[model samples]
Target: MSNFVEFTFRGQPGYSEPTAREVITSSIPVRTIAIYCFDPRAADAAQAVADYFGDEVYPGDLVLDEADRKIGSTATVFPLIVGGGRAADALRSITVSQHLFGIERVVVVHHSFCGATSFTAEGISAAWKHEHHTDISSLYDWDGISIADFEKSLNYDVSLIRNSPGTPKHIEIYGLFYDIGSGELTEVVRDVPAKVA
Candidate 1:
């Protein structure tokens, strides 16, 4: 009974959940999910990652149907932008992406001179307490709140993603540091699962 129900796949007549899922899977060939910061300077992070992989397509053209309705995209890399490019915020996205598009790689890129690096966990927590009158010290993990060191933060995020139950064991996870000024990516950590015998 919602007015916008017609826009959903399930709302279409004779289209079941399974059918919709299959249609979506065939539409976009997403193989990698790039998690990066929301900063405008970092907007090209997805394209950079795609270029680094040499097989992915970023900002690909959209596919249109006979009626000129948008059907899908030719892109292979899906960018998940979040604060600090933290794995904590991208956990659910990884799970959902795998479920929908069957992603093979998860890339976490923390850029240089990021706002997340400007404050400490303690400083942000205390500032929030004074400004918003709420104690957010316990709301999020201290290490995940801000980036003290690029290597440590990237390693922590990669480890966090690897240990999450929602993350498939077969998925390859990578932690990278992006120098915004240089537009260069340095691999900090990479966790590729062992091949099953």
Candidate 2:
């Protein structure tokens, strides 16, 4: 438990700012019905989304997995943390009971200048194999183009969810491409009813 435990608030550095501290201490509610914060740098991207919505989200997983831990009170931020999960396994995980956080409208955020989309699919496969020491097959779903491609990935994910027996019925999925340099988030796809979970 000691090792698995992570800091979402109270003990975190963001608590130092008087305004940020006051915002956190005031017991804000996490508006995250469910946030699928993606990116190799998921934490930073997630925070950007959180700031956008003025909601606290719990960190559900580190990288590959969907969901966050959950942060704050009624109007504050709540970020939930999930044990290590795979990135590709996320949408499917939510389909079943595999995700730590249940499925909800997901914020699929992929950043600009991200190594995940920077390299060719084959290039990343090689890097992943070398870095993780596995015979890596292609795992990344490229969302660098228009929102259609981005939504396609989400739709495919939702399809997997719908196929499962006990998936969420009312989940809406959204997609966005975030600019890392400008710290801007652009809507790639508007809200669409997810297949199921």
Candidate 3:
């Protein structure tokens, strides 16, 4: 297989390239699918896990445990797709990946004080009207796009994935609330285990 995987960042107005490819390394294992927001404030959970657990399990450049033996077969990460769920296109891409990959589990992480919450319905509609010069007011709702409350939004998105036909019934989905102030990850949905072993 090619070393690089194709990716399309949808609904990002400022993103220069419409699509890009990310190179995959032989290390990180693909046991779980972690869905984190594109916010830079949140820590990289995959990297943290790899760092704390030692490279024998999730090998990294700094991990030195049995480095020689773990060289080519060392632990690494699987394909991770990060984007804002507020956009319709992003949600579609996420669902499509779930359908095709059939990943065992998914962890949806929502952080406090997100940028998506800043966008209002009036602003979005005005932007659309300005760009397309047409009245699409009835097509989209601002309330749906905004993320005023992280916990509520997290639950809604979790439910959305659970109910989505694209995601398999066997796939376990989870919701996480990240407090940016204190740097903590709290599980919003307790019915299923969200932590990665």
Candidate 4:
């Protein structure tokens, strides 16, 4: 793939010309995804599991991760192991990536029977503190933030990214929920933070 540039149906060289067997998803990969999961060692580790599906795992580096879809043209997936809760801290931190890296969007995916989504906000905050060795004061609120809340938060986060001095200010954020039981990824709000795995 070419070096990360923009998102769209970027498949042909001529813009009007077409190839005989052009594969999609190469031209347009995912933006960024924040996940709430059972395993703490996400991304790289999870990708080891996901390798059965032919996915290359991008580990540790958030902005450099694909799905992050920044400078690298390859599709990347950044996994923040916010175990068993709404990854508000994870979401907040990802905004920093979007601002830092020129990523065009964000996606938050929560699963149907996820251990993370089953917990309370208090539980999540406590876990975040314990895992990150940080206090609770450094994050924002996602207590009421759900798949339905993506639209509102997307606009808000986009505003935050734009308003932040020196940020690229043209990126879009989205939120989504994936049904693990049904194996279906649902779009909760368009252009909002995704809560998918």
Per-model TM-score versus the true fold: 0.98, 0.46, 0.58, 0.42
- Give model 3's clash tally: 6
Highest lDDT: give the candidate number: 1
Worst 10 residues of 4 by lDDT: 16-25
Better of 2 and 3 by TM-score: 3
Which candidate model has the greater TM-score, 1 or 2?
1
Query: For candidate 3, what is the TM-score?
Result: 0.58
| TM-score pick, better of 1 and 4 | 1
In angstroms, the error of model 2 at 22 is: 30
* Local accuracy of candidate 1 as per-residue lDDT tens digits, 88-178: 9999999999988999999999999999999999899899999999999889988876999999999999999999999999999999889
TM-score ranking, best first:
1, 3, 2, 4
Cα error, residue 33 of model 1, in Å, equals 0.4
Predicted model with the maximum TM-score: 1
Model 2 earns a TM-score of 0.46
Query: Per-prediction RMSD in angstroms?
Result: 0.8, 11.5, 9.9, 12.8
Candidate 2 achieves a global lDDT of: 0.46
Write candidate 2's Cα lDDT for 1-197 as tens digits. 36533444445555655555455434343334333444445455566666665545544322221355444334222322221111244544444322333334555565454443334556656777889988656343433222224445545544544444555655554455667677777766555553644
Alpha-carbon shift of residue 54 in model 1 (angstroms): 0.5
